[model samples]
Target: MAKQTIQLQLSGMSCAGCAKSIEKALGGVQGVTTVNVNFANEVAAVEGDKLNSEQLVKAVKDAGYDASVIDHQQPEDDSRERAQQIQFYKFLAAAILSLPLLYTMVGHFSWTENIYVPAWLMNPWVQMALATPVQFIIGWQFYRGSYTALRGGAANMDVLVALGTSAAYFYSVYLAASLGDHAAHQGLYFETSAVLITLILLGKWFEARAKGRSSAAIKQLLNLQPKQAVRERQNGETETVDVAKLQVGDIIHIKPGQQIPADSTVVSGSSAVDESMLTGESVPVDKHEGDDLTGATLNKNGFLKAKVRKLGRDSALAQIVKVVEQAQNSKAPIQRLADRVSAIFVPVVLLIAVVTFLVWAFWLDAGNYGKALEAFVAVLVIACPCALGLATPTSIMAGSGRAAQMGVLFKQSDVLEIAHTITTVVLDKTGTITEGKPKLTDLEIDLKGVNGVTEAQLKQAVKATEQQSEHPLAQAVVQGIEVEALEQINDFNAHEGRGVSAKVTLSEQSHILRIGNIRLMREHDIESDAWSKRKDELEQQGKTAMLISWDNQAVGIIAVADTVRDNANAAISKLQQRGLKVVMLTGDNQRTATAIAKQVGIEYVFAEVLPEHKADKVKELQQQGERVAMVGDGINDAPALATAEVGIAMGTGTDVALETADIALMRADLNSIHDALFVSKKTVRNIRQNLFWAFAYNTLGIPVAAAGLLAPWLAGGAMALSSVSVVLNALRLQRLSLNHRD
Candidate 1:
């Protein structure tokens, strides 16, 4: 059989449940073997022999959500508008009916008693006259929604609400028409039914608004890329073209303050690009000819002509949108429990309600049918699954929001949930734990007749030689130099993977200053014992040594190394205190990795690992029965980041690093990692607490209401109160503080 794959664009997914709905919808299609729907991206990937995308889209549409083939992606604006219109109409109709129903129940004039109004005008027929259309038109959706859930063998909050309120109002109308003046007005529950639907709709409206805001993260990311660009024409002139139309080898002109339309390479001009939106870097990166640029990064200053390399869905912005969407839509481990409960919740609740009515009316011999009916209403009202429906999403929104505020942007709640279980943290040495760039840490000088040269003179020589080199150590030497009279040399030569050499005039005496590694010194035939001794000492101290040669003799040595972040020690200690094992993974030699690891108090170190081997190291840790989290801040770390149980990227790192990570730490501080974990643990705990309260209230409270300890009026009030309490408890997470405890 030939393999088949079908793609569909889906909508109406506010949480993982929606994704599951889409998956179930597609899974029901004939010949479909698997259905994977990413709610975050609103895309579904289906596989099977003879699977049809059109059939899958129709199935999704029948589930009350908009869907179509993947190639016909709906505009975000149009989707939002449709969602808003549906919600607004439902709210408007519910509100319009609720107002009059409320006034009739508790008004200045006694309409039910017929004191201010005539018997015919105040009759039960009149109330039903006004309420029947309201029930069918405004409240029918809830009833239908409940009916659908029941048929699917699932129970949501709607089932409890629809059954409870509808029974009360419908039973009251039957009593009034049959018993006439002897009928009890108290049994007329039309107002309660109308008001219940209104309140629930109000809650749903607020939920929809909050969900719209939460889901906007992906939309905002998508909006970062410009819609169009000025492509350099064949005649050397530029003509504006749609970004979607851009292809490889097309030269585009990007101006200062404009967003780059596609991932490309600079062919001409120089500029500093602000990549904070994508990379979370505060500083603008200097870009010259040949520098690769990403779509969505702003050209902060200057102008550049770049050849378009990757565009459309292949661009970085589009990839980020896709990842974020997938994460948001994917189910977290905890949500599965809710799904199981919902699958059988309605039938179980209905059975309990029927049994309660029979036990009260027949077994217990309550007053009459009215008493049994009251018990039935009480069971339905008090057994609402609002708390169950609210359990996961409220915690997710609060947790993800708090994480974002703490500089940890979780692409999905699943990542936040998994972070709590991480036992071992595998960190890349270059950027995860330490500043990746080399910086001059030590400088040594030895001269006889010249009296020791000033630090300023040594800096001048190193800086002049390194001005033309892009090597990490050379950049460090250049940054460390603090001399006023450093002059640029006309002739400069840089040897790849080695160092640089240049001639400078010192006191009118021409001397060649060559700066590079030990290999560069040997190649230049520079000799000096002092330089070797200094190099050995610095290396023992976990620093890289750069030999400096002057006129065919080694005159000095500059020590350069990637320094560990200031808060690394404290962060490591905190992680250990929390019962987490800290491990270091690095491409550097064992000596350097161990020396740095010892300083930071890490007991385990994986050294000399190439980029390709980092992911394997992460997998090895997992095989040891450890839940691992890999922390990194480079493109090379992308594979490991994706491989780990949880991937954390430093916010100050590259775009590729941030994109690949499950969680992006906004602050570069290692301590934030500790803080993020702390927040996740606390958030998960809060979710459990909220779930407990929600479940405890329904499990215990429903029995009390059915036992007639509470009136129907009181039961309605209590149900609303329980929902509010659960919401307030979830909000408490926002108040949690993550300051240093020790």
Candidate 2:
């Protein structure tokens, strides 16, 4: 079956159990293959064959939740803000109504006996009147949720809240009617029901507010795209239009401080564009004519008119948003364990409450119904599975979202979870540890002490041979030479892990030219004793040295040195400080690799590793019990990257590396590795904290409530506070600064 993925916006989920119920319901659908419901994000992703949107929505509704198909083609809506506002208003009204109930109940105590109070307000019937509206009207959501859960053969936080408040409310009504004339003076719980509901509502409002803040990163990303753009008309007139209206090949004018409306090539002007949003580099990059510009980056200075290359959803900003949203919605491995626990949590809690009530009523108290009823209500209210459900998803959402803001992208949830466990980080020296660009630092020519051929002629021959190869060193030699016309090279050959060779015809005379390392020279039987000394000198200086042999004789040496990145040493030192073993792996010779490693503070260096053997090296590290994270930027590194426990790709690297990597650092900055690890550790820690609170509350509070130490109303308040506390804790990840500045 050809499967398609669809994301559904969900509502009416009260706890982790609610998400589980929705998942089960959707999984039961005929065409559904897989379903993942993220309670924190309130979004469900489903993959299936010939899936019907209506059928999916019906299944969710049947499971007692509301679901709607999300149209990803449109800009994200602020419906969550509206939901938060409604929840806030409900809380405000509950708070106002609860005041009188508190005063009426507390005022009768000895601590406030001196305060004058109306006798009518003190009456049990009058108190019931004030609480009835609060319990039935303002708190209707709980009852509706509980009923839905019951109909779906499940239970959630709503079941707990509804059961607890109803017991108190109905128990008070029974007391008032049975006691008759003595009801005014007897103990009543009319205010208990009202106060509990109000407090819970207030906590929910706070939680909703905190959840909004957790997703603020996404909103900020969406806001980066300008709504309108000024398009330069063919007649020299400018027309303002929506960004969506601009198509490929359309010319748009960008001014200083204005966001580039579309991904385009600078065809006319030059300026500095701040790509910190995408690349995480704080420095603004200089742009000139013919340079590629990404959408949503700010034009810091000068004016530019460019032709749009990618528009609307195809733009880089839109793709980043989509990737981040998918990551947030995706489930991490830890979350799967939490979901497994939550699927059975509510039923177990219900059974516990039943057993607690039975023991108190029949065994302990021998029909002390009041004490038994209190324990039952307390047990039900204090047990909240919502906190457990929220532990991983919320933190993942916030962490991944914040990472995106910092220009690091975790393409999948597993990456964020796995990055924290990397024990060793193996860095590729060429593009990863040092700047990938290598210049032709030195070029020497030897005509065997037989003068007549100038150095310029030798350079032309080298450049012609280098042009046939795509290696970085070859490009450096080709660029460094000053040749107007290159003679045709026939029988060109490229040796894997060696270099290039070809037959050049200059002045109607043909000679074989081989440009490569010493190994290639030895295989060709070219004598290079003098050139070998020069190569060793260059290699000791951290420069790659290659020999050019012509017709079975060594001619000269070509050396190129790649500059180390500015933050290479600092990043490596930081990783080592964090207790991670850092190793440098490259194809450079031992001398050159050692020199570069020493400059970058790398303790371990593996040189002369061929492309195909890279994966084997990673395996060898794994055999030593090291959880290796391979960092590379070339297509040849793809196998090693896939073999490692974690693969980090530089954003400016090749597409193959990015596609294979688990983590993509948008810029060449090496510090992002430390930052990503830091964020991952923090996020995982936050999840653990949330889980502790969730599990701890139930583990401790259930027993205390069952022992009658906690009143049902107080248990209700604690339950609300427990869920709210977990959400607020997860929200802390949103403010986590990866820069680690004191």
Candidate 3:
């Protein structure tokens, strides 16, 4: 059976229990194999065979929530912004009405000395008149949410709020009627109920605003896509069209200082393109014919025409956006504890409140029903489950969002949380530590044979043979040779893992020319002592020397070396300084790998390891009790990347690497590896801080409220502060910096 994944936007999830309810509801649907609902980001991901999105939506609705299928082609809806606005207006109106009731209660305090209280304000009916609207009108959402959760056979933060405030409001009404004509405002607690709702609404408004800021990274990425493109018609005329209309093979024109409309290859013209938006490299890269151009990058100082290679969801920008959204929506393993506790937190709090009321009413203050009412209301108002539910997910959202802005993409929240514990980083030699592109760095020619073969003729012959090979080192040899004219070669053949040989018709005679490693020359029975010494010297200097032989005699040696990336040494030093063991894994021979490793300050080396054996090396590290992180160009390093505790892929790698790896570094710079770890540590630290406050707030507040020392109004204010403080603390991750100096 074929499987499909559907993502939906969710609404009305006030706590982790709501997320669990949606997950459970979707899990019960036919053809639904798996469901994950994230309360922090308000998203649900469902995977199943023969699944209907409508059925999933109906399931969520049946479970007392709202959901809609997300269309990635269109911009994300403004549901969150609208919700925030509505919350702000609710807070505003509640605050406006709450002020008069608050002032009336304050008028009874001796601290308001010399402030004359109006006789009408002191009337119990007047206090009830001001507080009634604040209780039912402005606070109606709590009652609605409470009813929803009750019908679903669950409870949430809303249930607690509604129960606590209604208890005080109704008890105060009973007292007012019992006193009849002598009714006084002194014993009435209407102010507590009214002020509590207003304060909770204020906290909700702040949380909504903070949540909006936490997702700003996705908004910025969505804005990068240009709305229109200049398409070149087949008739040699250009037309301005929507970017969505351009299909594969359609030619598009990009002028200087314009954004490339889509991911394409430059078919003509040369220019410098700024890829900072995609790769976070500030410098503009020079682009020539046949060079790949990414969408949303700016073309600087030249005009270019290109054929679209990818559009819509296939584009690099779209993929980044999708990856980020998934990361934000995913829940880390560390969050499981919080989720489990939150699922039972409200029920536990309600039971505790009941126990508190029973102890005060029947035992401690026997028959003193007013004191019992006060203890019950205070206990319910002070226990905030929302803080516990928001602790981990809010931090993950802010951390993942911030990481994306720095050109690092955490594909999963678990990876973001786990990266902090990686004790060993196994780095791939090519692409991870050094530039993957090899260039000819040195050339040594032997001319003492007196065979009438000049250095120029030998170089031309090597280039002719190397030109036919598709290997990077072979291309380097072809590029390094600068002969104005070359001889025509015939019968070219490539030997895998050894070299290439061809029969070149030079000087009107056929001569076999071979260019490859020493093993290839040895196989051909070509031997030269001088070339052997030169090859050793180049190899020791971290270069791969290809032996060039004419007929059966060694003629010259061409050395190719991959340049080390800038800041590789500094990045390695930083990792080592942090007490992480660094090792280099590569397919190159021991001598070359050791030389490159030495240059980059890496002590441990795993050389001559094939792509398939890379994972074995990682397993070997794990056996030694080390938590390993594998960093590589995600393509060839898939096995090792998958085996390690954390897999970090370079964004410059292939699609397979990006899809397989847990973390993607947009910049090729090795410094990003260190930065990723830095951010991970900071994010985890922030999560711990949020959890501590969440736990401490309830541990301290619940007892004080139950002991009858805390007033219901004060308890409500403390509860609101607890929820808002957790959100504020999580937002601190957005400002996390990896600004350590080298």
The digit string of per-residue lDDT tens for model 2 on 1-742 reads 6678788989888788888789889999988998988888788999899989999999999877788888745867667777778888877887777777677766647888788777777777887888888899999999989998888787788888887788888988998889854665666777778888887887777777776777677778888888899998989899999988988999999999999888999999999999888876778999899988988899998899899998766778777876787778888887877887877877888889889989999999977777788888889888877778878888988999888877778877878888889899999998888888899999988886633345677677788888888877788888877775357678989876778898877677777888888788888888889887889999999999998887878888899998999989988998998899999999889999999999989989889988889899999999999999998883669899899988888765112125687887777878888888888888889988998888888899989998989987788788878878888888888887755821
For residue 219, give model 2's deviation from the true position in Å.
1.2
Residues 598-684 of candidate 1: C-alpha lDDT, one tens digit per residue: 989999999867678889999898899999999887366889999998888875422422668888775677876786687678768
Query: Each prediction's Cα lDDT score?
Result: 0.70, 0.83, 0.83
- Ten residues in a row with the worst lDDT in model 1? 113-122
- Angstrom error at residue 613, model 2: 1.3
Rate residue 713 of model 1 by lDDT: 50
Candidate 2 has a TM-score of: 0.90
- What TM-score, over all chains together, does every model reach? 0.72, 0.90, 0.88
| Candidate 3 steric clashes | 0
lDDT per residue (tens digit) for residues 42-96 in model 3: 8898888988999999998988789999886886688888988988898888888
TM-score of 3: 0.88
Least well predicted 10-residue stretch by lDDT in candidate 3: 651-660
Candidate number with the higher lDDT (1 or 3): 3
